[model samples]
Target: RLAGSAAGWGFQFQSPGFVVAVCWLLFLMGLNLLGVFEVSAGRLGQVQTGSGRGGDMMTGLLAVIVATPCTAPFMGVAIAGALGGSPVMGVLVFLSMGLGLAFPYILVAGVPGVASRMPKPGAWMGILKQVLAFPLFATCVWLLWVAAIQRGVTFVALTAGGVVLLGFAGWIYGVGQRRSMLEGGRGTVAFCRVVAALCVVICGAALAQGLRAAPAPVVAGAVEAGVEPFSEARLAELRAQGKPVFIDMTASWCITCMVNERVALDVPSVQEAFRSRGIVFLKGDWTNRNAAIAEFLKAHGRDGVPFYMYYAPHQDGVVLPQILTPGIVISTIGK
Candidate 1:
């Protein structure tokens, strides 16, 4: 769940078209954390809710989803190598990630010893579950900070407010759940539950309004000072003309991207290399979701930003290491 939350808040939403989805998801998680629907659904699904052969097929389906947002260390190198190979290899590379996510559940189903040793659910389980919720909460806070940096205070305030509303709704729902559990009057429990549901609905609507009404982000136009903006059409045009192009796929919320830019890509020595090598330094500002850039990243087995690639004159591009130094950029251009 921490992975899911971080994936949504940091990696995925750096692009456009993902904010609403994250907001909705965070809201849903809020409900879950508050114990809103647990009362209705009874216990959570089995460790093997979808573990049989047929259900296991969904592993491949979930592969790309899990892979698409985690810019983990060594992940880029492995993915780039796979993408540089055959299509089958690339699919396998992606499927591996989904399989990892489903591994825990699969293990319980496949290994009797593991399942037999598992502690039965009881009051103690609730304590552990609540402890897990803290990590999710921390992830949300981290995401809030990231959102502020990328989308600004207005967006952060709106989003933070929405999160608050979801929490309030969850608390109300939890109150209702406790009442019912305590065998309180059915009418009172029903009233509290209905009220809680209403709160959640209002939160959804409020969030939608905030998302739609939010102002467009302002680009700092840093490239006019030196760098060139990167686009699919522009990149193809340059490459077809036998130009040397270095593409930087970056986002505002990406710490790695920022450090790379400051210490390597944008340094004075690297800028000189660009001039000497006649390299066209094109920047893909993945600070917001651009479908073109997203597709380009995926084509190379990348699920998130901070992608660095070099296209030599009339040649297939090469994926550069995600971690960069000035020497690295200069050396690549000299090639």
Candidate 2:
């Protein structure tokens, strides 16, 4: 809501604090899924009473948190269009997308026969829940990789320690819940809760200390055969010389961007085509926030990374599809 309004609060992708926060959130969620501890509403005790609404709300929240960083090929156009238009349009577009995502579950739930055919609760469900935890764990690993790229090794080390603390907190909390159920002792439960809270606090303190320290210097990577760092001045210089240029705006955290690079941009044939065609490749690293790159994306009617633009000499820049194949790149450059 804030993003669409005049407030225009743009998100900084790969921010150290944001990345660590998400990492911890996912790590804790994975622990929950693994049965370390169940989340409680405390005040809204109804949630724990199996009304089903709480689970639905949690599913929706998890989906939004994990999916926000992604700009899928199919939805890229719709998202860009929404962001470029009035706030009303943005809200409507997002709501429509949400409906699209939820439609499958809604259908199954609404259809009596479909619901009847679903399997009844059993021990298999417990096994399945534990299985699902792995994916969340994998996602945490990926986020840590993003943190390493942006903030370097020190950040990752501190974040890893925080993960340990979180796991310990979850464990202690689970022990408290079990004891409270078995022995029904209030004092014991209160002591366990206090210890768990302290662990979490210490974890937060460690993360804060890590963030206060300056990040390790980013070592310059070896330049690829035909690629150069992207900048507005360089783009203009190439255009003035009437040279064809291909701009790759990407980020380390963008899975689609990474896939496209491996499958399309880095393919031998694509590299050969660039060499033969005398095309200049400018690679923009949006792994960390860059205002210039953000402005370029906005100018091109996009609000996220994985943006690709091809500028032919004497012609306007052409935006390529979000999902690319080697054939797509070769053919685009061939033109």
Leading candidate by lDDT = 2
Relative to the true structure, how large is the alpha-carbon lDDT of every model?
0.67, 0.81
Q: How many angstroms is residue 20 displaced in model 1 relative to the true structure, after the best TM-score fit?
A: 4.5
What is the TM-score of candidate 2?
0.90
Report the C-alpha lDDT of model 1 over 1-335, residue by residue, as the tens digit.
Answer: 22323221145556322554455454555457545645312222233363244444544443343235445444766655554566688679767865786789889999999999999989988677666666656656656665665566777777777677666767777777788878876887888778878876886676667667756465432465657887889998998899899999887656678788899977789888888788888888766656677678877777666889999898888888888999887777677
Candidate 1, TM-score vs. the true structure?
A: 0.62
RMSD of each: 7.3, 3.1
How many clashes (backbone N, Cα, C below 3 Å) per candidate? 3, 0
TM-score of each: 0.62, 0.90
Give the per-residue Cα lDDT of candidate 2 at 218.
Answer: 54
Task: Give the candidate number with the greatest TM-score.
Answer: 2
> Per-residue CA lDDT of candidate 2, range 25-125, in tens?
88887888798888733323455656767766666766765676674556777878787788899899988988988988998889999888899999999
lDDT of model 2, residue 271: 90
User: Candidate 1: which stretches are off by over 4 Å?
Assistant: 1-24, 27-67, 71-97, 112-128, 145-152, 219-228, 231-245, 252-281, 291-304, 311-317, 322-335
Clashes of 2: 0
